[model samples]
Target: MKTARIIDILPQCYSLFLPPFFKNPIPIESAATCRNCAMLEKPDSHVHAPKFFSAKTKCCTHHPDIPNYLVGALMNSDDPEHETGRQRMLNRIAGKTSISPLGVFRPKKFTLLSRNSNLEYFGRSEFLRCPFHDDEGFCTVMPYWDAVCSTWFCKHDAGEEGWRFWRTLRTYLENLQKILSRYVLLKMDFKPSISGLSIDVSAPLTLQELDDLPPPEPIYRKSWGAWAGNETEFYKQAYTLIRQLSQDEFARIEGIEQKLLLRELEQAYGLLTTTPLPERLKKNPELNIEKISESSYLLSGYSPFDPLKISKRLYDCLDFFDGSLTNQQVIRLCHDQHEVGLPEEILKKLHRFRILIAVGETK
Candidate 1:
């Protein structure tokens, strides 16, 4: 049996390596592959999923199975000519992001990873088509992993940000792995675990040994507690770390985080505003981009109101409306003066509204 290796130590050292601005991370493989992760909205009640999985889930577990080709590219560092990500990354850096040290060291789902760090068991949703993925469906960078990312995969959480988010995850894991490796050697006096494990901090680390560590909790898939309970708290720490960095270091990490946040926010925010599928459909729906495309808008946690409120109000209002109501009329119904309420303009944009003007002219 092959031994397990974990970058339990690396996150500490390389926390500064990550950019600030706090983009969510994507999984390495299928979201379901992660025995530790969960699918929100109760994708399924299968015992392996996070607490949110419900039997009513209709999301089919078909996250385009990634063949060895894409995996091979990710596993190796053979940067291909078509690797548009390099440019994309640079462009994002030039855009809204600054190079700042992000507070990325917060731990997630310690219990799950601690119990099972099996790399082979990632979810299919975790597998993805990277934005940089070519028509051939292969990553441009086929080599040179920082190590941790080469081995991580997702639990196929429906909430997972697409592969674009994985870039930072890849970097974070790589750096984390390095930190864990060094710490393990120091702790073990420079020796591998008895099973010749690639890495093993399984020696039962104490909070003391892991001191100076941020108190982080696990979030299912790429989803997190966007409320003051978790999201704000988590972002606070992340920004705090970035703020401490010198301009150059902050810029470096911030640039990467900006790209990550934008792509992830695309999905999260979209879900926030769009009409959540019928309750039955949400319980058992096709999760392909095609199916998801029908949704009108992406509402993000960034909205002033509770993300679910907009969705709930939309659903409740839909129930009150006759299907015959014009789209504009429906939008008007959703409009509210309360700051927490959805505005017609913003709602229209969020739902990707299609306005049709009646054309009657003297011909």
Candidate 2:
């Protein structure tokens, strides 16, 4: 009922009603309003452009009227009628003074969620903003945003050091952001096959064993990618307590991730930005990050995170070598998976591509 900000999660090429790879021929207006919904102004933007009205917009497809989502994602719990039942931010936040030693050894409880609970939340599958945020000013969960939320604040608020309890929050967030930034922006190639259409990759995880990776305490887990399918893959889907990336942080993280990927392989150990990249690259047999960087900009580059250049180098390397390895194969080899075996999730990807030439899968 409150005016909340929301974005439309429209599929890029494929639509159930439209043809595959069919783009929106109509241009979006200055307000970023879809042309499909140009006529209708009231609550129902549908009566105007009925043709492209998608269920996702929660109204007409052509005339999309998405409510702006100002807050972060959340999961609702039943009202806290009992004294003990309550919801806390579920992340392993690094600061605070609320809990004592005895509290550490205890379990926290939350109640069942209903359509209308005290808490307003989104789907648990992927990360999103909490629905309880009042569009006008403050967040409903401010007092109880929990440890992680309490700790993180950005350079935007230059003078205000968040919480004062943890000055190191920014550093930790930066490190985690570096790792998250890489995978979070990785665009997946979404090919539509009828087989996986109705399958639910985001199942409500239930566990019989309490200790065996039980469901994340509702508000605790970072969520992202509630927007699925083809186009959404190209965007940042990873949900975290603090979502925005400072310009410097984004650049720094990219560089670090590139270094990390290159360093994981034994061949790229001596790579230095100063060393002649070509000379250094020629010596290393595989996954030479130095070579990739040198060749791309003639050894005149500085950022550790260059996916385009790296992917190009990977392709070029794959082309030159007469060996039987594919691009994905080189990636797997770079990961040092032989010692620890391929992870099940990665194994699924390999199987999908039919690139599992190496034997051995865990049962």
Q: Which parts of model 2 have CA positions greater than 4 angstroms off?
A: 1-28, 31-249, 255-363
Q: What is the lDDT of every predicted structure here?
A: 0.31, 0.25
For residue 278, model 2's alpha carbon misses the true position, in angstroms, by: 41
Per-residue lDDT over 264-347 for candidate 1, one digit per residue giving the tens place of the 0 to 100 score = 545553443243422111101111111112333223221111121133434344332333455455545546421134344543
lDDT of 1 at 250: 36
Best by TM-score: 1
Clashes of each: 64, 29
Question: Model 2, range 93-196, lDDT digits (tens) per residue?
Answer: 12211111111101111112222343222212111223223223223343223223333321111111111212342233333333433333342222323111
- Residue-level error in angstroms, candidate 2, position 8: 18
Which parts of model 1 have CA positions greater than 4 angstroms off?
A: 1-12, 15-171, 178-196, 199-313, 318-330, 333-341, 344-363
Q: How close is candidate 2 to the true structure, as a TM-score?
A: 0.18
Candidate number of the best lDDT: 1
- Residue 205 in model 1: shift from native, Å? 20
How does residue 363 of candidate 2 score in lDDT? Answer: 9
